[model samples]
Target: MASGMFDTPIVGVVNNLFGGLIDAPVVGRLVRRGLIKIRYVGRRSGKTIQTPVGYRRSGDGVVIHVMSPDSKTWWRNFLGEGGPITLLNFDGADRTGHAIASRDEKGRVKVAVQLG
Candidate 1:
């Protein structure tokens, strides 16, 4: 795996645990901040992919900052003209949106979603 600061074995385990907790029954509904799952089809493989990530509300939409972008491939599906996405919003709703992924000069990656 790539050597990003968050690309450690413990980090992966912690992320999985948190993902499970965030999606747990009853209590999952109470997670109204920080965590969310984004679903989208693989642009190349044509398979549906879903993963949990952190997000924050941005005006009329949401912004997902892709941590360790160099070590992750899921965000690449939204490159160029971008594509459709389904976000498991903090409200416990599957919100549809258009996602566009971009990388800045500093190598920070962000997927901006315009919820519909």
Candidate 2:
């Protein structure tokens, strides 16, 4: 694996071999508390589009960082057709957040802001 490429297998290895429990809640807490960042992938293209996303304590007030990247098909659908964002907690419970970014500003610095 390439450097800094800590993929799922590596995570699984750490979790299995060292008994490290790396789940959504722990990761989400890191993201929530601003320890680590949360990245969002484009649903259609499966590309990493958002990084350093900010999440609120209640899992609301989600801010996405696109880093000046072009919008993808999934983002288009999310903007046009209106889609649901499924956020899973550590307990495997999925929470729904609403996409509330305006069409005119979707391509700007602020992409989509999901609020619970």
Candidate 3:
């Protein structure tokens, strides 16, 4: 199997653990200090994907930095500057929002989700 195959499972396991902890009471608060969970449907496969991402609230929206823009395709779902997204906040509230993805000159991807 390719080397990338190994990372898939590890990432999934980590995400699951973080997702669970972020939904808990006390631990969730601590975890939310640096990460937030984002749930979005695949653009083509139509699968629901949930991942923990680093984010910060900006004005009326949240900003998430996508580490590598080219290798990751999930961010593509928000490329059109509009798409449904469920943001699992640190406070244990699921916030509905519209997400927009953009890439800077440095190749860093930034997703802005406008909360409803």
Candidate 4:
């Protein structure tokens, strides 16, 4: 799948093969249209995080999926500070949000990050 575009050759091949099992473009479209919202939590501080992922919307509240398989810098910061994140939305406004995820959630924020 196209998701493998961000990975090494072998990993990309694996990602392409695995992505075939899911409708990523549909989900991406849903996410872009604001129907799907992605919620991230601080790995260390237990705070809610929200960000408008690049995708289109199918309707309202469709599942937002993650493509990468690792942690990011903001994820690390969220872990250090436990509080809900207010993400910037369309019209340059901030959105009030919270995040709650279980082990079975579509995506999970982990406790790893690079700060350089």
Candidate 5:
């Protein structure tokens, strides 16, 4: 199924719950297996936003797949290919990187980050 199909309010609640657990000690270790916490500054608001996203490490960078591209705006901040972001890796280290967002013909948004 397309990731967008799961972009409901209930999913947001569940994602938030997982995000909270991923910040804890033991639980975080388990939760980090499938999710990552991305820290980025809001483009317009200028406030720091933290959200849990599914990601995979590719070579020297990480790729994040946005479930609902149209409904989400965080990816917009990386459109110009120079947005700074922090990815909390499963190893418990924060990796600083620059990210660029792009969308496929299917409207799937992918943000690739090159670690610094």
Candidate 6:
């Protein structure tokens, strides 16, 4: 009776719920420490989308590992070469970056971003 979080049906619900918590004024303070809000434009749809994901600082930028890659589509936008991205803290302070997504031989996906 235990369904996975990415098991369709409720993926959007989970994203919206977590996204709201990460963007909240008070609760976001702790959550945003490890999970910041990421905003990007869809390459094909030309629409702006915001999602909350876990990331860590890497050199001058940050690295985000996409969980259950097959269940997600956002990272695909950064495939091939890369694209412009904006990472925002709970306070709404954003850091602009260029993101390139790569996959290991094991099919694990991760996005390496260079902040500017």
Candidate 2 regions with alpha-carbon error over 4 angstroms: 1-28, 32-60, 71-73, 90-93, 102-116
Tell me each candidate's RMSD, in Å, in order. Answer: 2.6, 8.1, 2.8, 11.0, 3.6, 3.6
lDDT of 1 by residue, 26-76 (tens): 777766477887889998899998778888899878999998898877888
Candidate-wise lDDT, in order:
0.83, 0.42, 0.81, 0.37, 0.83, 0.86
Clashing pairs in 3: none
> What TM-score should be assigned to candidate 3?
0.84
Report the alpha-carbon TM-score of model 2 versus the true structure: 0.40
RMSD score of candidate 6 (Å): 3.6
User: Which of candidates 2 and 4 is the stronger one according to TM-score?
Assistant: 2
Off by over 4 Å in 3: 1-7
Stretches off by above 4 angstroms in model 5 are 1-12
Return the candidate ranking by TM-score, descending.
Answer: 6, 3, 1, 5, 2, 4
Write the number of the candidate with greater lDDT, choosing between 1 and 2.
1
Residue 35 lDDT (model 1): 81
Best by TM-score: 6
In candidate 5, how many Å is residue 37 off?
0.8
Worst 10 residues of 6 by lDDT: 1-10
TM-scores for the candidates: 0.82, 0.40, 0.84, 0.31, 0.81, 0.85
| Residue 84 lDDT in candidate 3 | 93
- Candidate 2 C-alpha lDDT tens digits along 12-104: 454343222233445545433532233345657677543233333434455544333342223343555455554444224545565533334
Q: Evaluate residue 45 in candidate 2 and report its C-alpha lDDT on the 0 to 100 scale.
A: 67
